[model samples]
Target chain A: MSDRSSARAARAANPDYKILVVDDEPDLERLIRQRMRRHIRSGRYGFEFAGNGIEALEKLVELPDIDIVLSDINMPKMDGLTLLQQIPEVNSDIRSVIVSAYGDMENIRTAMNRGAFDFVTKPIDFADLQVTIDRTLRHLDEWRAALASRDKLVALQNELDVATKIQQSILPDTFPHVDGCEIFGCMEAARNVGGDFFDVIRLDRGCLGLAVADVSDKGVPAALFMMSSRTLLKGAAVGVGDPALVLAEVNDLLNETNDAAMFVTVFYGVYDPSTRVLTFSNGGHNPPLVVHADGSSEELELTGGIALGAVPHFEYGQASVQLQPGDLVVFFTDGVTEAINLANEEFGLETLQALFEDGEARSAREAAEMILQAVREFAGEAPQFDDLTCMTLRVADE
Target chain B: MNVQAEHHDGVLVAKVEGRVDSSNSQDFERQLHEAFGDDAGAVVMDLGQLAYISSAGLRVVLLVAKTLGQRNVGISLCSLSGPVQSVFEISGFNRIIQIHENRTAALAAAGK
Candidate 1:
């Protein structure tokens, strides 16, 4: 159970209720105090006596923490109905329990409409009165608990909003400078915080490191894992010679500390502008699409490996392909192909390949935008379940 | 959501009906806890009539599964409708818990 709910349960179990008892009968106060002597001694309830509704209001003003008002309908200066109406105005948190005659159903109903929380007959049995008091306190506890949870939810949403901003800031806004490459990346989380990350880092010897990854879980835990994984990959990629070796080192590091059993599927590549050659590695990620200048596309199914954090000391494989001028390599997470439409049909790999097959010439940024637009159009009214991320790299004409 | 429970073939079968969204997930959790009690036996969840489930409902199901696991009570889910099955699949819950085709299969799997 969450802290808020547990606290509510505790309050319901042991309540230190304070009640103001108002009545016109002069001897009623002494009788009640005597009847509830054991309760008073135990510190479960503390009482303030009032002869009429007007006096009850005064007591309430002095002690705003008073939780309940036990009052008689017929009083000298003020009636119970009048006090009930005024009680809410002074403090809406206060609940009123009316004392009425045995046959006063009409007045009891009237008192209820006027804001009485509950009622007990004039000839009140002490045992029945005790039960009513306990029941009324239980209701108050639940009401307060609900209010507390509502406030906590508002605060939690604000914190998530700030977290979303922090996650967005972690991504690279500008791609690395590569003479023969134009690169772009975009990420959209289904929730305020998501587990998708992409980066383009300029490595040694004018080589650019490009990566896209998706974590296994959702929300803050996934977001935290994504940050750690992205940081580790970027830290290892800069000094490492091989893309597969970089992933292997990061995988070992993640496996050592991954207590949550969370894993990430990643595609990491290194592009050398001088050779127009791209060396890449895949760790259980979806195969990227390589679209040739002739408007034909092929799924870039490289040597495969399991996702990071699943096993330690696991070997990863590397593959290379030379990119011709005007060729495009588009990388994405499963969220792209698995995107569902209103009809519950996936957008699918065929549709993605078709889009690339018949598309016109565009920059990396424009192409990324077009794909995102198509996904949104396909998803019409269906809710997005996973984080959507995509990256595109185009070889500029020589 | 409405959950009805009955003992059949030496197994507790909980028939869940309607959408188990955030609005009533708390009540649903309470109902499950009340129905299961302290019996460390076999429990079968029949989801043949369940239409939808949200994250809140999933959280409750996880809590119940953990509690029952700790108590050595075997729990299995059966008869998931299409939409609910999709939710379970996407969340990776299908990997952790045992799921069967129907109540009879679930009972047999639980060794009832």
Candidate 2:
């Protein structure tokens, strides 16, 4: 059988469906209703009537389940074409058909253009009307199903937005203060959430702790791992005896369930407030730059083991530096130095070190700002591919 | 910066107000230490009037709490607004510090 016949057969197989008829002529409406009574009486379908587009809209509001709208082209107050245009806006899932006694080519084209499901000329063909109603109702069912799925997708998007907000709220909002020291830091994510994180914590007995870390990969999973690592680091710093030992314990804790194959690069340190001394350990992280008081700086050589979550038994090594007053330590993720320009030239460590040689950075904050400005200038219009994060620390004389 | 201290029954209540940045953190710290110098049984801090707080402010709170913890004296923070509460929560201060909705609840929790 044809597609229309198949649709009608499907509707006949499933009794108890509804269709709405909208037209201005009472006689025509009566005749259509009388012809439709056979299908209604047979429990195949039900029929409702509307005098114009206005009445049809009211009926739609009252009964949202009115499967399809069979309307006339010429009607008082509101027409079939107008109703078709409004259907998608108000309730796009409701299928519509345009029926008219005077069916010209222009009217048919106009009705179809206005989003009518189909156009039927009126000489009172009951068989054709049944087929049209059946096909329209089938189309309406599919449209409604698609709309339901879209609504669910929108709800999921809203939930994700809320989750992102909660994650952002957990991060440190502002930097801390140290006497006679200036500090600067920035975090830029390629997506909603990033893997890079930095923190400056105050320790007991005139001591301060500093940390910079990069979780493997990006997005939600990385963000989650970053949070867990942050919490574990805080707990270890507060409870663990030494920085290297803290990383060892954190590594074991993280490797407990190592199925995801995720890992992190970290540099954790603690600075003595009285002696201007900072002791730190690296866990396969990038070496940070240590700027001296006499306008000189050098990269702190990495002396630690592999990154966390690589192996359960790995150990990190610690290093110490006596920072004089006005000395600065600059820590960053790979994003900053690796940021590329339109010419594909990376803002490498050499360029960063060169910016420091300008001798314009009087404080740690100025140093951070200068590096950020240099990177932005170098990148020009190129979009950031990863999270750009940095932290600066200045030691003060007691 | 506004610092107000009053002794109610055996509880010492200190109300801190305004921004607590590096410039005024020392003054706030000094005032808090002085208020707690008399070996008060319990100290309740009312932060409702506090509008802005930086890491310096956080350090002051942490220091006071640690000092009180060592002395076996209880410290309770109360009436924290949304922003101040957010700062504390982000820094994990809420986890270590005892935060209450009001001074009465805070004082009661501190065994005042």
Which candidate number would show the highest TM-score if scored against the true structure? 1
Restricted to chain B, the TM-score per model reads 0.96, 0.94
- Residue A112 C-alpha lDDT in model 1: 93
Clashes of each: 0, 0
How many clashes show up in model 2?
0
lDDT of 2 by residue, B20-64 (tens): 754476788898888777668888999999986654466577767
Instruction: List DockQ for all candidates.
Output: 0.06, 0.01
Best by lDDT: 1
Give one digit per residue, the lDDT tens place, for model 1 in A25-141: 889889988998767756688778999989999999998889999999988888988888899888999888989999899999999999888899969888999999889999999
lDDT of 2 at A190: 62
